[model samples]
Target chain A: MANTEQVKLLGFWASPFARRVEWALKLKGVDYEYIEEDIFNKSSLLMELNPVHKKVPVLVHGRKVIAESFVILEFIDETWKQCPLMPQDPYERAKTRFWAKFAEEKILDGAWIAMCSLGEEKEKAIKLAVEAIEKIEGELKGKHFFGGENIGYLDIAMGWMSYWLPVWEEVGSMKIVNPLQFPATTSWMNKFLDHPVIKENLPPRDKMIIYFQNRSTELASRPHDWFRT
Target chain B: MANTEQVKLLGFWASPFARRVEWALKLKGVDYEYIEEDIFNKSSLLMELNPVHKKVPVLVHGRKVIAESFVILEFIDETWKQCPLMPQDPYERAKTRFWAKFAEEKILDGAWIAMCSLGEEKEKAIKLAVEAIEKIEGELKGKHFFGGENIGYLDIAMGWMSYWLPVWEEVGSMKIVNPLQFPATTSWMNKFLDHPVIKENLPPRDKMIIYFQNRSTELASRPHDWFRT
Candidate 1:
């Protein structure tokens, strides 16, 4: 049933959000046609398919188009029953989702601020980013992964920290996720990235560093309040 | 089994997030203790339970505690296994989740800005809020509710708009979800509020207006960038 339906993913190469969908689909062993979107000049198809946000990582499943990476990840999990990303138990699943939302709402935004801002703003953002990472570190204690030996929904949801955090750190010439501060998260990031599916699918690190370096410069040139939204 | 478990809800009276959990619990016919929190002065228990966000809508089911309104709603639905908030079909469920996320991310923020800001910022926020509401209006076209015939997950997720939007509009002396601009959403709001379960569980309207009025004043007096976070 899963094989018969057409599945297409609109993604940008360097987008951690897009990478999440790709990793989920790959883990599920679901066949999908990946369309690389130029985010700078979004394709008409991408805009048409996801008219609301017009963001990448839009999953076109048959006639239905699902936008938002987390939504897409859940769709992929529910649609393809193999390699379940979410936990089986309701309690565990709730715990997993709590952390996932925390990552999306706090860590992601804090990390973005940490990378993009300069001086005092950067200092405040770095503090926020580190605090968020430390919480994840506490959650990861005595666990191989957020899914406990399996790279499940929460791990995939927080997967960006494994790859992009390092890129952001290097590009900004600053550090957030370090061994002393976040030992468990550091260990979890290593295991998460070292996983076969995740290892092979990541964007080239050097290229990502260059991309973010340019993005930081571009953002810095804008008005002080430009990135407030 | 659900009846056997001790269920307690830690919530604030005026919080739409906390109200969501209450509605879900009542709909499920699950008996639970409701503990009201003074959001102004944080309780040690609330802080202990939801240390990360330190926010409301914390559901303590026996020993297991779940925070985040959306996460708690899903947990309640799964744990009770009756009066299902989510759809049975996967695609429909994905759509429900998508709109829920959309409401939380876009409409909530835009409306908050619209309700709280003044002068140019207020005008810009009104535009953004209206645009977000218009998108929901389009989605609600030809449907009695976002959940189709039943007031389901999306409807509940968006329940705040029915009550709070009006309050915000009256308090701010502005409009966003009017019949002329958002006919479908206006109609859906009527049906949603008319639903017995939702009507019974909502925070009182008069109290909410006063609450937001004071809140808007407090926000107005703060440093211009105070609410930026």
Candidate 2:
């Protein structure tokens, strides 16, 4: 995989978004060179390629730069032709992509809500967190995976919530996903983390806790500041 | 087009999400029977079709139902090959989808920040609004449409922001994309609204002003009670 077809990933190992590409690539068994990026210490390569987002988990297929984790996943799906991320049927594919979006936008961002809220806002955050979980459970009911049996796009898109959110809770000193209240999500998170493909590729829990702890601190310190280089 | 595909759209005229599909349909010249639904008083059919979200801009193509506005746009791109909504290049398509997500999560959500923020949070909302415009302005600098020249996925993704945001501002009596501050975004919004395909598909500005005024009053009056609904 060189010249125009080279598959190289710019990522920080502990990132859930990076983990998303790792799981997909590993599952698909695609050979890609993983370049570790310390996002805080910005690299010229990362800066040039993803000048817009300037975030990691940018997949470079040949010369084409595809930013956005979910977007990269789609490109990977189409390019690799292994471990299909989406269902084959147009309607089913639409359904999977919908939940993929829900996971990214709501469940992941719900962590921000939990972390940011104070007193009364905390209660609202908790309620929204529960709602986010309940929505996922409804989507997951009677299906082994969000894609039903095989782990598909929704599962991969939401894969972070399964593996990383708990680490976020541990580091941020906030407990949003109470197992007692959200047993389905709790169990699913564990089950997903334990799944062999995911387990082998899983970033070390301790490192993630440290990374996300620093991240939460940094974000809270400057809630409005979009990353300054 | 009529008998071949059972294309029916459940939408509220005022909703930007619904408008995404309306514009996509109009751009592709796809004939679809549009059913007007009151968002709060959503019909049983809309609920039955989109049980999970139970939200509008649900596209029913034959018996298959596609929910979420972006998902629907993708579906439309797939179903009707009249005009390709996405890029032919896989990487370009991925980039298009990337900006679309950014538009939904960051750009439009920025508008909501202005809508929802009050007291201390209001300042942060203003910052987010500024960031939103700055980001979009940067994205639109050289490109005629977000997809360049052609109104593609990004244009459809952000279709609502062009008209509805101004309407929302008029209702709330505030300005987010100030002409002097973000001249590029201001001009981009103007160019966007002027596009013939978009111009024809927009909800009547007069009605949208009324709708947004009432909606703004509803939100402003019960600012803290947003979670109750």
Name the top DockQ candidate.
1
**Roughly what TM-score does model 1 have, to 2 decimal places?**
0.96
Query: Which pairs, if any, clash in model 1?
Result: none
Candidate with the greatest lDDT versus the true structure = 1
lDDT of 1 by residue, A90-110 (tens): 999999888988887677877
Q: Given candidate 1, what's the lDDT at residue B64? A: 93
lDDT of 2 by residue, A1-229 (tens): 4333768999887777888888888888887899999877879999999877789888887778888788888888877776788887777889888887776656676666556444665566556666778877766656677767677777888888876777766765677778887677777777777888998887888876776666666676443343222
By summed lDDT, which 10 consecutive residues of candidate 2 chain B come out lowest? B220-229
Estimate candidate 1's alpha-carbon lDDT, on a 0 to 1 scale: 0.84
Each model's lDDT:
0.84, 0.75
